[model samples]
Target: MAIDDLLDEHEQSERVRNWLKNNGAGLIGGIALGLALIFGWKWWVQHRDQQAQAGYAAYAEAVKAIGGDDLKQAQAKVAALREASPQSLYAQLAVLELAQAQVKAKQLDAALATLKQVAADSPMKPYADLHAARLLNAAGKPEDAVKLLSSYDSPSALEVRGDALVQAGKLEEARDTYLKAMTGMDVASPQRRIVAIKLTHAGGTPPGSAESI
Candidate 1:
């Protein structure tokens, strides 16, 4: 209400207007950048969610195609899913299905090729490797089968490895691998009997006290 107070307030208002004139653009730019970042992050999340949903939908279609009458069409769908979403576990599963379909159709070479690629790229290495190795043996490439199975450290793969080694003419090694497989297997497992039979084939005799099923 006083003259001095009014002058002081007017001066403060003027100072604020001057600062705004000089600095407003920078402040506005900074605010715009922050808003852009927030919206951009939201957009990215939404985009990823959409992509994941679409990938799942495609995978489902591929799976359904497997049950249909057209085996080749199903294989194509699965292959497409793998190409579109190679990093996805669903895609890896599709690759497995496609390879098996190829196998049933007597497309052994193509099936092996698909399995090999899946083994190289998939996170499910153990299953993929096993499938590939078995098919390699069936394709009469037992040396390659043994080589591929060697990558697996899991006890379950030892049985397949032993079989492959046997076919590869490594009788002693096959017997040893089968013995190791037996150690890892449950006593009552039917797999134990199969391995035992393989061990017998390698050398008409079980190692030490091990019994053949």
Candidate 2:
């Protein structure tokens, strides 16, 4: 009976040792996994920041090239940044800049196309729409310009719409639109002068300008 008791005690000790060994391994594995997750998250964040920085740097270089009046080189750099990070803010801004450069180079069709794409997009839709409307107005499509500007509720859109209405011989509507724009205009804002001019041309007196009704 004593021997049997001794054997039983020995078995219990072995079981306890095995259990301790297994638990120790599990604990070590859990700690290692936690560390790996932390490190992995940090590395991912660093990588994302690096990508963003590189995209922004490329955009800056493109801007510098533009300042040097090297439109072709600037376009190439913008293309590369766009390809590298199509969803980045820098990429979107680069596209807008490239479109403007195209306009400066008198590549109006390309500019219009790019601006149209941006206009239809959800992220930059307002800006793109405004630019597209401006270009359209410059291209002598005042009615289309008005339609495009009407899509946005911004003060600039109101001013643009007023200009389009005036150009289209809708003087009464133009006067009303100009008044809405004038509500937020300061003296330094070109809209102030613009609204006053339209009002005078529409046979109305400008509030701050020395002009006849």
lDDT of 1 by residue, 1-213 (tens): 766576777798898999999999999999999999999999999999999899989989998997677877987898788788777888888888877877788888888877766746567767978888888888789898888877675667898888888888989999888888888877878878777888898884654464743
CA lDDT of each prediction against the hidden true structure: 0.82, 0.77
Candidate 2 global TM-score: 0.70
TM-score for candidate 1, residues paired by index: 0.73
Residue range with the least summed lDDT across 10 consecutive positions in model 1? 204-213
Task: Judge candidate 2 at residue 122 and give its lDDT.
Answer: 48
Error of 2 at 8 (Å): 24
- Candidate 2 per-residue lDDT, tens place, 11-110, comes to 9889889988979888889999999999999999999999878877898987777666777787688778767776777777877887888888898777
TM-score of each: 0.73, 0.70
Candidate 1, residue 67: Cα displacement in angstroms equals 2.6
